[model samples]
Target: MADYTIRVYKNRDYNAVRMLFAEGMLEHIPATCAHVLKLPRAQFVLFISFITLLLISRSYLLSLVSLAIVFTLGRRLLTSEFHQYVESCQRDDLLDIEESYMASNNSCFWVAESNGRVVGMVGVVPRSSEVMLLRRLSVAKDKRHQGIANALCHKVIDFARQRSFKALTLETSMVQVASHKLYEKLGFQKTDVRVFPSLFGRFANFSVLTYEYKLRH
Candidate 1:
């Protein structure tokens, strides 16, 4: 078994983390669709049917059906729009780090590594003197369920407490029930809904639920 470790991200780890993010997102697709389709096999069949129809039929009806299936699958597949959003989040995180560095305030990125390979990451930013924002929490599928996210959250909370921050906050989609439950178990409370402006202009109606956790020092 490979030994897993969690550490602060270094500049050299950037490429590895980006690769891991792509892999993690792809791994999450099936589970994301399963929540809607309620059956993995059925979803697979529908996906195949959509592709077949797209290749064979020029009928407006078939194209419409294909479009619907694509919409359904794309939501779960982490398509270009989703990837762009995640990239935007990463850029924001880096910007936060740069700003904090300039101001001489502490900010850091953390990653989970197994056998010297990056597998997961979490970005933490101080929102105010008393609050921290937790964003971009992700783990490779194979490394999940081993308490990687739990450990990462705990570490960030500890870091916040050490810095005397009063609370931590995060936003996640309502469709991500497993993540919602995880945050709840970690003592986070849902506080509001957050509207994420779409970069692709396609998923403009989507919103994410926000949660907060108070850290008692």
Candidate 2:
């Protein structure tokens, strides 16, 4: 909260950026679990399964076993989802950030510095000739409630405009409610909500909300 400056990504800030991203993302697990449990399919399956087991055996042990099984399945499903997202991040972006972002003239990464330390970071990767994906935005946990995130976002938006991008967009999980607020405050509008396809996506049952900031003349 004292003072912070936003600057282009430096090689030295890579590790800090990675750590901030991992920590910020991992913080969503609990929220994701709660959201998953509230889904209609989860409630129906858990209730029916438990009730059926109770009526068939009436044994507390069997009922508990059934509960454990169902709960474990849900937990494992979410854990797998978490890992998949993390792996995708590492494989697609974080692993070779320089090669993935720095090497390209259209892609750029930035970090927020305070007290001479990397406290926050954000990046923009060109998704098409006219669009950029605003991604990897995060701030240190202890550094929240400050203006670091806002500054980082402003910097990314300016960068996009200066580079003639037509729009800036991002995807965030439903669990990332706080981020949604930030994006909205920055003039990004929620445009869509979608879940990934395939068995794992069905089992885990999470939705990603997409937001877009259309640049205007």
Candidate 3:
């Protein structure tokens, strides 16, 4: 068990939150790239493309080089998508805490402090009058699985219920199995899943899962 304090997010926590989110999300890229590449469709396409190159070039050396280049380019494209998401988060949310989350009274953000340092974060924003969207649940890499995530989750649940929100909901990627377990433990149900809509998303073919917690019932 880590000794920590959980409290409302402050302007000073911006850099830490951004850093944690980026590092955590980026850590998944290697797994994500391999996941994408291992798909039957992905492997088939790569194989077909390589064979075409071999026939055209008719040089075993050049064909192997071309195949390697394709693998590199494909991985780069998938990795860049993750980078772009982190950049978008920095631009939209981390740029100004007050204006983005704290501006509206219904929306609130919080952080967990361990040894006087920001080590975890979670936030709730209004999706509608009766519902709140729980977003960006992150804990420090070294400090995870020590109940910090559960504590932060309980804090947000209490906050939303106190505000009379009917339900709390969140979106997460399918690869985030750990997060899924945490949300499930907290009584959120898997309500929906959608394919990533971005161009890179189409190629990667991974889907996002949405979870919901009905406060009243």
Off by over 4 Å in 2: 203-205
Q: What's the true lDDT of residue 157 in model 1?
A: 86
Prediction 2 TM-score vs. true: 0.88
State the lDDT of candidate 1 residue by residue for 1-217, as single tens digits.
4367888877677777767766655554555444545545546766777667867895768867776866665574546555765576557644344343224344567889898888888877778877898876888877878888898888888888888888999888746677899999999999998655654232333457999999996
Ranking the candidates on lDDT from highest down gives 3, 2, 1
Show model 3 residue runs off by greater than 4 Å.
59-62
lDDT, residue 107, model 3 = 85
Candidate that would win on TM-score:
3
lDDT of 3 by residue, 104-180 (tens): 87888899998878899988888999999998899988999789999988888888898999999999997888999
User: How close is each model in CA RMSD to the real structure?
Assistant: 6.2, 2.2, 1.7
What is the TM-score of each predicted model, taking all chains together? 0.71, 0.88, 0.92
The runs of at least 3 residues in candidate 1 whose Cα sits more than 4 Å from the true structure, single-residue gaps closed, are: 26-78, 94-105, 199-205
Query: What are the lDDT figures for the candidates, one per model?
Result: 0.72, 0.84, 0.88
Clashing pairs in 2: none
Please identify which of the two predictions, 1 or 3, would achieve the higher TM-score against the true structure: 3
